[model samples]
Target: MTTTTIERQRLSIQTNPVDAEFQQQLDQVFTEDACALLVELTREFRPRLQQLLAERQRKQARFDAGDLPDFLSETKAIRESDWQVAAIPADLQDRRLEITGPVDRKMVINALNADVKVFMADFEDAQSPTWQGVVEGQVNLRDANLGSISYTDPNSGKAYALKENPALLIARVRGLHLWEKHLQVDGEVIPGALMDFALYFIHNLAQRQKMSTGVYFYLPKLQSHQEAKWWDDVFRYTEQKFGVPVGTIRATVLIETLPAVFEMDEILYSLRDHIVALNCGRWDYIFSYIKTLKNHPDRVLPDRQVVTMDKPFLSAYSRLLIKTCHKRGALAMGGMAALIPAKDPEQNKAILAKVTADKELEASNGHDGTWIAHPGLAATAGAVLNKHLGDKPNQLQVLREQDAPVTAADLLAPCEGERTEAGMRTNIRVALQYLAAWISGKGCVPIYGLMEDAATAEISRASIWQWIQHGKKLSNGQLVTKQLFASMLDEEAEVVKGEVGSDAWASQNFERAKSLLLDITTADELVDFLTLPAYDLLP
Candidate 1:
């Protein structure tokens, strides 16, 4: 709002500057006037983010003392009272299938043209958080919104363009825990969440409104309703600043953290005016459960593959979400189907069958829709939901009042499967490969035929830390000690090096990825998050 900021549109936000071409794309979306507005907004919200993040650490310390999270006593009335979120718009009502990917121009174009009902343009876990990647992602999103996005591959001369009828677009910003070092307000870095949200909301709100489509979002990594309240306040401030109507922005909170599961009702109430749905972020939720209860030996989870939706803890969590969302007249979305279709007919058939079974369970249990990471599997997942929700927008009307009540213990059910050296080695391999790709500016990568993202990488590394912290015994009775893990990590790094070839290993960020993996997994004290140190590694 200052005259200087208004007069001069360009200012310092990034450590490394972009060239004329890149700056052109940035200035298109981030005009001189808009940059001034963003600076003011960041100054207003950054302090609240810091306070809430500190609150997160305090809550973690309490958890370390064997205290568990429960429904908030202060918000008990909000939970028990008879109330519902604002009415959902038509385009958002039937989200049977959603495809998620990074915000690269080609990826965005393909995802929009995919067969899914919604495309979650991911800027959080699916992005590298580099200055170039973050700014270019905004450029791509702004172009996609105008229906003028396209790409031509230099290697193959293949052209990609938007289809006649693209899927609805919903942007997922960075979580509260991250910061954008490029943008400084009073010499303090702005929260990456604010940067991503403000850029998209400011750029696309009017166009979306003119098209009668809601400017939607996927809110990630919310640990408490208090955090949700902060986002609600941000929405209100943004609306009032632009003279936009209240409730015009819709958000789906990803219940990915342990504390969030217990506060589902309170979180919905906090953002009730703009809440549209709740998504089961299964991978990160598992990662959170491990980290939140890291001190307890009995709560240590089995292999990642064994912790399926059918498992007791996950089943209880998903059931509770469905019940809670339906009771409040909001949509309940199931977790992502991560398996990508294979080249071999037999393998692809099995993967499709699994996707169908997962989506069927979600629909039968009153979930409104589900998510798929690949376009090929959309039909499989969508068909199941379509069968269950024939001639209906969603299953919000199908109240599962007879479902068993969920207790705290049920939500904390212990793992029952075997913990083997195979699982341990798998985690090490995945962490190295995924982190390498992430460091090389590809946050979403397919490893062993499955699409992997930051959540998967977090759990992979965190699982190793937890296994070592508790001195877990494998099925063959081998203890997971530091020495054993170190030897295995070296072997896995070699394996990845050979798999990716010597040329790629030398050039494609393998060194930093290996170093970060070793540093985080082997440290005496667990690192807060792998991304924090990894972000510093970016140019």
Candidate 2:
């Protein structure tokens, strides 16, 4: 067989085809010395993959059979008057500063005082699952009571409460499908009835306290566009039952699934008329990637730094998302800036600077808002956003800029040997992995012998691009050009061609890589910029 054919075989293995003919060919190609080992591994993996596919088929069948309970029906069964009510002030949407406080303490008061857009009082990921904690969190939010509530650290036993202006609040609720019993530390099951009661109680309290309008929710883990549609229907039913306006209750769905990416158009259409926006979710997305591609151990995630947006596939995906939201005339908000290092002052400053730079890029790219997990980070984000928003350009101009054409030479700019090189390499690897995985029809695949799947590709690409466009760079060195990057990709492809055959694996990987490289080539000017002579290192 020719060298290209060998490379194809390698690609086929990475892609994982179930076709008997392909298997036969692969078997024929294996050497006697390693044939048994490869066969054993294949034997072990095939059934597991089959099982996963079977499970998916079963779940889809259940859905088609209408076995999935209707959340709207459940929500509508409750009476509107049974919950409390409040009018959402018109000015709430126009507020500039937004604050999210972990505990409802003085945070709400601070937010209100600061006149922020939203005061998010998180419950799902932030607070303990105990009923007492839920009740307390509700009370603090409902009453806008930021004072006289002290929290003791479970580990350190240190106690503290807010003494200054509290942030305005929105609450994040537990997913309707997540059972408290499953999360209990004491092994005690919390009944469904209790969970429902808690939801209603909080809903009622918010209404009664006249906190209706800004009393929004952060919905978690919505798996499909259909799920968003269900939630919209539920919202409509609940509002009518409660005698509230159709759009009174607002929500942002966390887009964190592979399926969710395809369902984006549907999801937005489903909630377009309702109070809904998309929030890019990272951690859960990573978890989902792992779960979806567990059989491909070779595609396991590497270090966090390795994943970023400079890679072609991810950059395209993220841009597509932003474009989708913008097309719908809705907010295209950026994902969480969790990687902002806050422990070390210098590191925190550098990360904040990077985040600031990113926000500018996002806003420039047409995103309206972004997220920051911590109070400190929020302040930094606010500053960054405020600076960008201050100079917010006309929509027409932005669109024109977005539509402008560029060459492959522009997109492949070399990274000056500084940290940027590492960043670029990371982005390239991630992009290659994503292209390999998606084109191969496998949920995950290995690149340069490392395992990577869809989720990793998405997050890494989003992040890396954010860095490339916004991260700090040196001033003196020559930047890599798009032509150079194209050449680099060509070199990589030639290497693969020499190593693998034109079999299923090589075919899929090469096609995917070509598509991704073409995407990058068409979009931006890839050029390496000069590195600065001296730069302040992040601690």
Candidate 3:
């Protein structure tokens, strides 16, 4: 009987049919190199994904229960008057210190604490696109509460209490993708939460009891005049829907696109009623340059260490932007000084010195203010502002002298003839290099041996092209024939032969010649050269 008894086999059952199927799929599809990834997918990702789904469900449930404050309602409470379009005080506008807060919470608190005029809490480049993080950020900004944290100088060990300043806290929201992500749950994009948050914060702030000045937004990635128009429409719709005043939402569009460079006036006009200022986003602009010039084999982004503001194309473009903004009666704000190192004291000091010099240059060139990307950089901004504003430019001077109206015709103004053929040819060379770069999609090109890596190819090309396009029209009172222009281009191409090459000799010499041309040409000479009608054509 004992001999007849057999050991019973213990059975193991696979309870997860999905896991089995997933493993089978992996085994069939994954190669050896991918097997590790497959294992991670099943073992690590599945559980994390499940956890994320559960958390999302919880958040949705809370949202559905109306646990969150209604954004539209809050916005309605803030936007009661003509607060949106009220002219920013010359003092505030003239106050050049711009401190960029790392996070919304930090930015809001920093704005509350710092003496800088503009405090931007970034959501575009500075943020991680995590769902919980974004939601919490929105909530924190919407609530406009930064708990009782002491604002202190890390170096000096000085602390101060930060009071809330409605006007100073500029909330930079997530771009469209993150915004969409924020509203989605289980793959369904429900914009109720995001829209609610935006509407509540903007509208309510616009309509608040003290009617504290309307909160501003820093608009990023504006690609065209149409993009600016789109934001304008969104703002209008949001305000109207919430019964917020028609123009209660104000924004500063970062001109980061190649198209945006040419359409600055158009974009400004489109958002004229709603825009507070125009910011030149340098890094993004550089990135755009790289993308636009991807087809060009000769141009590569110069090493970052070599890039500097003095490069011919960069200097020219910077000047052009400043002039254009001033002509429009809008603030021409300088680009971000984000290179400041927060950890290294010496690097910080050197950056501050450069920043001070830059701000002086910008202020002299008519930029209203510049950007600072850290709390530590606030002192740099403060010093520059104090020095520049110590003897403020007479507001009457700014108000009385109307900026010369720039028309399509003005874009074609020719350089006055008071120079030698060499000088005129030099100007033409600079203009041609810019045009080639533009057509090839580089926003800025480095002049070898002169500027490290400062000039933007896009800005140079746009400025030069605008002049050429407008000049052609003005010169002949009609559009120039492309065939006729092509002939001139061919001739010039021969004269400037080997200019577009990757060889070190060709590259170095070309840049050197271009830089020399920029140096020798006078402002008037350059303008005249830009406006000069096609050589074969007569004025």
> Against the unseen true structure, what C-alpha lDDT does each candidate score?
0.88, 0.45, 0.46
The segments of candidate 3 whose C-alpha lies over 4 angstroms from its true place after superposition are: 1-95, 104-107, 145-161, 164-167, 177-179, 185-209, 341-348, 391-539
Return the lDDT, model 1, position 122.
94
Tell me the tens digit of each residue's lDDT in model 2 across 1-539.
Answer: 12212222122222222357544433433334232332333333334333543555465455434332122332332211122112224433332334444434444444444433456565543332333344445555544542445556678876655545454455666543333332121223332222332343333434534633433566766666656665666566556655666666666667665446545556766776554456556545554443333333223343345444444423443555565554554445556554434567787687778767766655556555666544555666776566656654212122323553222222222222233555445555555645554443333244542334333454444333333333333233434455445555566555555556567445555665555544543334321100000001000
lDDT of 3 at 492: 52
- Would you list the rank order by lDDT, best first? 1, 3, 2
**Model 2 RMSD, rounded to 1 decimal:** 20.3
Q: Model 1, 255: alpha-carbon shift in Å?
A: 0.4
Q: Score residue 151 of candidate 2 by CA lDDT.
A: 51
1 versus 3: better TM-score goes to:
1
lDDT of 2 at 519: 52
**Worst ten-residue run, lDDT, model 2?**
530-539
Candidate 3: tens digits of C-alpha lDDT, residues 1-539: 11111111111111122345434432332234222322322232234334533553464345334332112332332222222233554434553667654343444565656667766765545443333334345554544533343446678876655575533556666443222322222333322223323533532463342544565678765555655665676667556755767656777777764435656666676677777677777655654443343333223333233344554434544555665555555666777665544346776577677767866776565566777655566676667656655666312123213445333223222222121223223335444564333222222233321111113332332232333333333233433233333344445544666565556325434444343333322222222121112111110
In Å, residue 303's CA in model 1 sits off its true spot by: 0.7
Name the runs in model 2 displaced over 4 angstroms: 1-116, 145-167, 182-214, 296-299, 309-314, 339-345, 391-539
Q: TM-score ranking from best to worst?
A: 1, 3, 2
- lDDT, candidate 2, at 126: 36
When superposed on Cα atoms, how far off is each prediction in RMSD? 2.7, 20.3, 19.6
Task: Give lDDT for model 1.
Answer: 0.88
